[model samples]
Target: MIVESATGRRTPAFDTARLRTAAERSASGVTLPAVLPATALTVSSVTLTLANRAFECALPAYACSPASLPAAMPDTGWAPEGRHGLFVRNHDLYLRARDGNETVRLTSDGAEHFAYGALSGMSLMAVPLMRSQSPRPPFGITWSPDGGQFMSTRFDERKVESFPFVEAVPQDGSWRPKLWQPRIALVGDAERGDVEAAIFDVAKRSKTVIALKDGWRLYGQVFHWSADGRSAYGLVTMAALKAIGLAEIDLATGAVRIVVQEATPKWGRFNAFIYSQPNVRILEASREVLWFSERDGWGQVYFYDLGTGKLKRKLTAGQRTVRDIIGVDEKRRHLFFTAGGTDADPDPYFIRLYSTSLDGGAARLLSPETGVHLASRVPIGNAAPGSATTAALSPDGNWIVESHSALDRPPVAVLRSARDGRVVAVLETADVSRVAASGWRAPTRVKVLSADGKTPLWGTVYFPPNMRQGQKYPVIDAVYGGPQVTNAPADYREAVVTMNPRSRASLAELGFIVVMIDGRGTPGRSKAFNNESYEVFAELELADHVAGIRQLAERFGSFDLDRVGVYGHSFGGYTSARAILAYPDFYKLAVSSAGPHNFQGFYPVEGLFPAADYGDGKNIRPNPAAVPPNYARLDLMPLAPRLKGKLILVYGEMDENALPSVTLQMADALIKANKSFDLMYLPNQTHDFFRTSAYYTQRMWDYFIEHLMREEPPADFWLEIAAPSQTTGY
Candidate 1:
């Protein structure tokens, strides 16, 4: 099994003099005459760096004229021709030219909260709560193909309620608490955030607002532009998120037209957290559209007439679920996509690539490997017109590049013919010999029956590197029982398992057995599997985890069932806390971080759960005054009295996603029950408190070592966070 290992090379720390010397020795024949005295080197009207100690040639045309503009946003609002950079400051849009230091104000009517080209939405939930300066929001604008004009969304959140937050321990070293009130919409609030689309012409310096349906707002931008450049397209969804429509807007008239609309009995999803996208592709040349849906129990592709918005045919079928659209060769009428649940593979979660005709035909396999094949269609020139996470296909659409891996295997990149699933060449195989030599071992793949005793569950088992054969170790269940994603990594990646501080691998290093199971409700399977926990948040696949653990104890002699502990964050945090309360005899201890123990306080707008209980009127049931019975069943506060195992609650004081109140409420309940538990609040941190993760991880190690292992930890053992290294450098 191939495994990836670090290149083990440090970036050369070059000072200004070294940089200047390197630039002088460049192959471009650059010398002291051309090299500027400043750190930056402008060669051939482009910014070049001598950091690599090499003068690279044949760069992209855009690279020849990099923007030297002082910008507010990172990686957004750049002209299609790379001639200008766009940014929002003081709620107004400004353009900075690439060739010269010419800056122009694009809009003037923007006010404090009524802003143009502002990035504000459910996406930045933690912006208001954090103690740090509010980051400059991106100008949520889309550039025209010709780089003459751009379209942007206006953010109007002035009417939304200002949620109060206090920096108890001010970062600025203030004596008193600093109060901050940011416009944040809560459940049952009458006024929430709103958005509208508008076009800004560069030459004329004029703006035209698009006539959209009331209550409809654009999130990002009009992602697609027509071939004629006269129109653009974007997704439109209501507050309920139960339906989604592809709308086309005329550039000149600013008139909107619905290209196609799809709704589900359950709420439709535009994006599921960060794991997936809408998975919609518009074929403008052919006047056709390809969309993904789980209507047939599995995610399948369908064809529709773009102009008529009528279903033409179902392009894909069966139990296999289409994960992503890789590429489309319009001239040849070929479509490539990634999918899981092939009948031949024992593991249903293994993703594979398939190619078929856009006119509808049997899908031809493109990656026949017996593992997860991650096919990518990277953006090259004008070939693949999708984002990095959206789609990837070769320029010619003749070859498919995929990295294949399994639980115990590393990655092996292969190039296959797009016409057929033939492995034309083996590009690279990860070398883990160095890691192996250092006594590192691959995780063991484990499978067992779920709580139902019929469905199969997959997971991985991590053992201590120096484990003795005769002695059993204490088991720790590294769980994130959220339905949105699976915790178990399908391949070998440090972030997923091997070297992540919070991963099971790291836990196993402390002389404990670590296991991660993807229970019934997690995604990457059939719709039936994902819907298992639809309205029932309390269940959270804990029973399935219990069953998996019980089965593991019966099969292997290495796991100690009596000393099992559970740990997770966010939704996983709720599950980890719930594990001890529900299955006290199974999970002896639990560490929960940023768990929204009560559903009444916070609810995601993803539409996976009922939104009406919180005040949304467009859902299945709308009851704003009283806690809905469905939400009542999800509250862990009432279950606090049932806790018999050791529990510790962790939270970031400034977290907005899980709310500080949820953790405090759980603590209050435990106290009312006269229960003894540990509580910790991270100062000045938000939902993703990655900076102080090492300290928390060390505390977790101490807690597990003391409670589960029944041993004393070293006195104040400081687990210092590793300094920035080339291995994980930005």
Candidate 2:
């Protein structure tokens, strides 16, 4: 049943009439939405570096020239391209002139190739020692500190592995079988081989090999350099079955040294916090190596001295994951960052700007731990109140880049004085301008007691556009449950749901509620809270989720638990699959997309273990043989059949991460057990279907609506499940 506030009353909730009009409105006026969670998970599309304005975004052109970027762009890599712009254009390298008008073509063949950072930008334009007649596509590129040199990886084909998957036909296209095999995702023999890292000297306009030792050499990946660019450091493993080594290459002296080996995880007493986002999200942090490592039991800030070729010093300690490396005030020997510790009452949304010595010492939380997440460094010059938290330090340590926002406030970018942390020039104002026309609904902050009331968990509910105070509606709980990730929306501009355009419409048009929460086990809280279910990953995570649902069920009378369905992808998928089986009565239906039916299947060849971080290379590990006598375990696949609700199991045929093979294993078990489940399979898609955001989204939304909204089995359900949908794009 749908509920609304009193007519003609001043209310923050969206009325039915207004919502209907919104759904009826065309999709254009809507803000052009984000297509996918950034593939550059480890880093963002744009980075704010020491150059102050030397922000880098992926370029699209092969012929990138310095004259292509905006004049206001900051200088980075020491040497500025003509216009000081860094970008990836058309999978190639192109430099936006300083004037930001004309673009210089850097490389000729990037059409089918993909290169990530700036070194690739300058390399495209940098004169090559020898350009192959049949040019190879660029893979990865890194520029030297001075910008005159760059390191690039050309992964030559002829020796790699590739896999293919199925696809679905679009509603507008005639049904036909289509094949999709995304490169780098599932490489075939034709695309096989290894990578080569070559340094290109822009000043000399020449290419030189730093190191070429290998069978299947993997260079160019972990790119790090000595402060002066006379030497470079990286971790490389041989092409052998299992390779491991940290090598230091002397550029000027042409010497090589092995500093470390077997860098990947092995049996050890180490701490690990895994997240889907690739790079460390901590920003505005720097000083002596400017990085963090989890090698120790804690994820701490570490300053490595390349000149000495050793860990310079342990920066920050304790259980906190040095969440964000804010900025390093080198002159003051201070590194600014954000993290959650035992110091806060609730989760420390307002991460304190911690200042510590580069050589490791006592750390202090700078922010009061009040606000939610923050934007990158604020601009320098302006002095807005509370602007200190958003301030970013300049290259010379004289100015700062300023930015700010709150859960309900949109971010504004302006310059602020570093000394006083005051705002200067305003670059952007509140941008909710688009969603504002149609009243915006802030997520209701609610606290629900855990099954063990001692641990208080929190969640947010975004009542549809215009929701009433005490309303009952169908809610879509978008679950993440992964310890390192949070599904809760933190800032105003960054919405809980990123746009796929095609699917969002159907989601709201079909009339359903959406919800996301970060229950216990999620990162950023005190270490103990984050460790509640240590050895067991999903059990407590989902329990907290179910508890939140029950609390909402009681607090908001209209929410129909009978119609509730759980869903997620990867870990999210793992969570949803478990939700249905673990709390059979709490969830009525489930839609697990690209889920793993069993952990053993995806476990590395080393085999399954209790936790990735468990074990001491010498012996003390959670080996199964020494299993505790009484352990409450969650067996999803075997237990799925016991669920008394509609179930849809989706998989991408070519998934490499949560290999489809294991999911298929579960499908077989479900069939033999005679349990009812809906299956939707994608073709040529990897476990990270993150690249194909559009279709996966539409199908997911439609699947939810078809099952949850319509609440009925489809007549063609078996037919759709019989074969792959034909129109999928890679």
Candidate 3:
């Protein structure tokens, strides 16, 4: 029998017809009963929900199959607002009225090479060095509070380099591949052009361009239009993002003034995880501004007098880090924010809501519970308590909509009094009866020391069902050692497999323990702790992982130190392969999918590659000689010969994030080094294996089962399900 798998891969199932034919023949030439086949076997269908979607799977009476699921969809395209909004069409910006009666084209020069909004159509398969000529639009446009005028950045990349990738199409019953080249601008490329801030007068139908001084560039989308629509504020950094400065732009004359600028020796590069985005807010009535900085070694909010261009005071000061600003009550001189690492909380990663005054007074913790608190302020002057609301601010600024949860407790939405931090009314409580009935156990949170022996590292462990005393189990280290994302869950019900529990839990069912660790260089801690990977990405990052595993094994008796496997996607994928290669004797198995193994050969952008401050303090430029060595240390190609365990590599042919070539390069290097490994390439799939994730999942399961368990998977084991009918809503 043939069955369609979740990734649409057809697999062979048990041949029921042959079984029935064999039952008809008897050894004594006597006719066997038709019920003989049914005596010991029962065929049924089970509808299982994987990744929040339902799939019908066929299984025998006593066995269950793991359902393979697809990856989450990417958030792209335009998001509209109210009656009028701006969007990109055919690479140009267009403003459309909700009634469909009026439409205006804001940009006409937009083209494939030079488009408005972020650049598109470039395949990640191409080499990044050759794609530097590709012109990209501003991160996005900032609309004024009144929506009359908007501020955007125009990226000029006509002088940048170009690269090409082949687009394959099937025509006339034959495969045809066409070459397409796109121009991209690289961070350190000398030919990369400049970006200018442009303000479009919607009513006046005119545009004003604000020019920056020489040797300066706009950092991401740091500019924002004022509420009164008279000026714009943006952060300007040197080309390499070493020295950062905040500036106020004059709308009338296109003049610019530096409000605040700081140069730090530790300004290695612009990493979203390690550093907060430039959050600048303007108060229309007071002409004051709130800006985020880490100058004092911790993320804090600072108030500045815009008129005088001088600092008023730091609104928040503590060992804790300010996460984000929720809402500002200018009338009451109050500001609400989210922070982590509170001194009173046992879990430093648990984020809480806090309220502070504009005059630099003490900050009051609004939700002081020992859990992750997500708070939203209700619209001022419309606060109605005891209503079934997701999030709302009180009219008097006394209450807020708070959703609280911990590692053990499910989420509960409640209306809490801001003054006393008391839950006034419970709006919603999560029902965990279904979870309990399913026999699913929450992973136990574990704490371990970093390689430094002083800093703390957090992780979670999932044990196999029906554990026996003194029995060791093979451990699978599900790693995502990306500096940008933290893998360990902080809130209640925030499991690593929350979206796809069966995907990870199935590994545990297969008789292996699973673990996720957020080691050093990961975000959500203090700035200094996260800077461990600054210029040293590979060694320091991997040291933490190795130390965490060893520490956990020493503490937990059930962890089998001899048998270990590691796996992850993208950045995690890079780490997985590096783990086995770097520590061949420890990690016995690895499955790395879509990893940028050859980091230096691809992109030299700010986040992709690290830069150092030479202390010249005048103009910081990328030193080509300094980057190659760092890349050499992290590149897996040189270490391919160190592979001493079972390893499988996977890549999507159409991957636009980490190009397929990056993975293929490692394969080529492994061949040259004569190293044994496995490789899989899925066609027509992008960075996320939305259509082929199930195929790879099964492959990974088989690899670990055969290599680590020393047992063979079923001859025709098939995990079948249907493709997602629609894109994921999230």
Candidate 4:
């Protein structure tokens, strides 16, 4: 296979054998031990033996799989009171006995496009990298406290439009290229399909569909099931995606009642409290429900009488928004959560933990540290420190495991008393000496004003290892400025750079300073700050990035503004391409891999304007005037003629997240415009790059070295990655 350029010329052939050898050599030197759980497990008064182990691993194997490849069902823990657990394998729900003896299939009609517990295709790509550690529960299932049944959704998308992708064939005749159809429901498509709530009774081996009102779409997974197993609760939004409300469904009659509804005409949609997950809980014993809402322009907690469907009171209120509900202690009448922009700290996005009571009094700060805190619920008897200095309350509500870290320090796990936020014991601390010895430099935290010139934006600067104080170095902007996530690391665990092939540190090792900045329109900030790009998605983000770059260059003399390169995956890919096309004089080179460039072309439904204007009504019909002009301005095809930088476009032939057609469309426009650029199509690869990350990393480094630095990279160079050992058990 040859790399194609717009000029109808082929670049030098890449030597895969030599590249693999170099990668192996590089992987062998990274002997840092794999991270282990800080606390030990104790079951039935038996303390299990635990040990720390390390293994070398190459890129994850999942990246090279075909587009239609099925992933193994994640292990869902056993039911609340029963010996059976639920899992989905090959689209069918199954009940497996804990003893490994009895296994029963629950649904036989479950198919690829239509299945129980299936999420929207658009949401599938937005799943975070961290969540990939465990298989996602099918369509977000919610099991009853009694374990008699479970509530989930059955998605019927058989009528939805399907996009086809061609799988790659091996050159040596080892495999053959095949066409794979991935079903996707575009926003404006004629057949958008439907999703219904389903309740499964384990004992009776029965299933019931609680049909929702017509012209509405399910918002998230089933929130919770009533204690008596007679009702299930969930959230739903209008077909136009404008108004949103909570609903309670009677199990026996399948009757639905809307508890609360909120709408925003300005934005044309109800403000989603949190992205990606349902942030609601049921206070079963009290007959009250705790739900998250942003009706007051800030995300906060609210209490509602479940029986009467009446608002009791707002549990949390202020300029700050609750980021997440960490845990709910019904017995103690306490609610633990994480909030941002509440503290007096300089960084408004730094998340801190807070706790309040069911009666809604003053909330007590649990984590007073000045960094981003991510808290979770600790197991009943486990005493290990939580993952970060973030607080994780124990089931009893008296203890919290605090995992603390900063920009310059690795995580130190400690046990703390929940009542007064006092440290009780140190469980473990990260050993980063090996990483330090490997010449990895901790990024310098930097704060710069946003393009508005008042709002502060946070970022990090990674310098070359052998840097000279007086010398200037070319810089590369490592961006993932997607609305869903902030690229900057707010904790120490993330600050510790490793030799991973996908990290910014590894890229910085190639003789260039790498920087990451989280500008306006990203999450973890105020609602207004995050909404800056609501309608002007493309322009706002790119402007902030440019402002950050200029600010960084002003603050530090090491950054060479004249020679700048940018690269990112997925959303970042879109940003990188826009960076060069929109600001041709600033960015000299860019690598956009799997970018959804032609947003209007690939998913026209998403491209529709007045975002809330949808459904079967004259007033809701698409208005071209309402559509953001940035959509066209950001599109690579329309801007192809304006391309003035050295751009290398990469795409996985089977990338389901950002379909390959988007990239092909951009290339086609570039070719038609008679512009010179390079293109690469990886066969059978997915969005994450997985096994192929090393190869792309090498290509990116070589591209920068050859163009930005005007230096020739070693011919047939390869990087060796350590493969995880099969013998070690953690």
TM-score preference between candidates 1 and 4, better one: 1
Best by lDDT: 1
- Which residue runs of candidate 1 sit more than 4 Å off their true CA positions? 1-47, 50-77, 99-104, 125-137, 214-219, 270-274, 342-344, 381-391, 431-438, 466-470, 494-501, 538-540, 603-606, 614-626, 690-692
lDDT by residue for model 2 (1-730), tens: 1112112122222233433233224222342222311112111132212221222232221111111223333322223233234455554455444443665555554433233332221121211212113333233555654465666665433233333334454222658754443332221112333444666555454556666454324433434545565666554544321344445666654346665443433221112334211111111133124444545544565655434446666778865655655454556665666555433335444344456666666876544424443436442332211112234555555444435555566766555444444444555576666555545555565667776666766666655555467666665666766665556655554452332111222344446665566777666555456655444666787877777777788877757676777777776777888888877777776777777666533332121123322224222224442312211253366675677777777787556556676678777878888888878777645555633645666567667767677655344432122123332212
Per-residue lDDT, model 3, residue 577, is 90
Clashes of each: 3, 94, 12, 20
TM-scores of all predicted structures:
0.86, 0.62, 0.78, 0.80
| Ranking according to lDDT, highest score first | 1, 4, 3, 2
Error of 3 at 180 (Å): 4.7
Q: Residue by residue across 1-730, what tens digits does model 4's lDDT show?
A: 2212122233323333433343334434533234321122211111111232322222322111112211233555457764677877788888877665678989898887777655655554522321245576555576666778877676678888776666566334667665555567543455656676777888988888777775555666565666577877777777444666778878776778877666744332322334334456667678877777767767788888977878888888787878877677778788777787643566666677778888879899877766766655432321111111123666567766557677776777666566766666665677778677878666788888777788778887777888888888898988765665677776766665321214577767778888888887766666677667665555677787789888888888888898999988887788888888889999999988888886555554331123433343423226433323434544567788889989999998667778788898889989999999999888656786733456877787788899997899989899655554541220
lDDT of each: 0.71, 0.50, 0.66, 0.66
User: In model 2, how large is the Cα lDDT of residue 385?
Assistant: 16
**lDDT head-to-head 1 vs 2, winner:** 1
lDDT of 1 by residue, 589-687 (tens): 999988888776563444657664534443223455455555788888888888888999999877877778779989999999999999988987787
lDDT of 1: 0.71
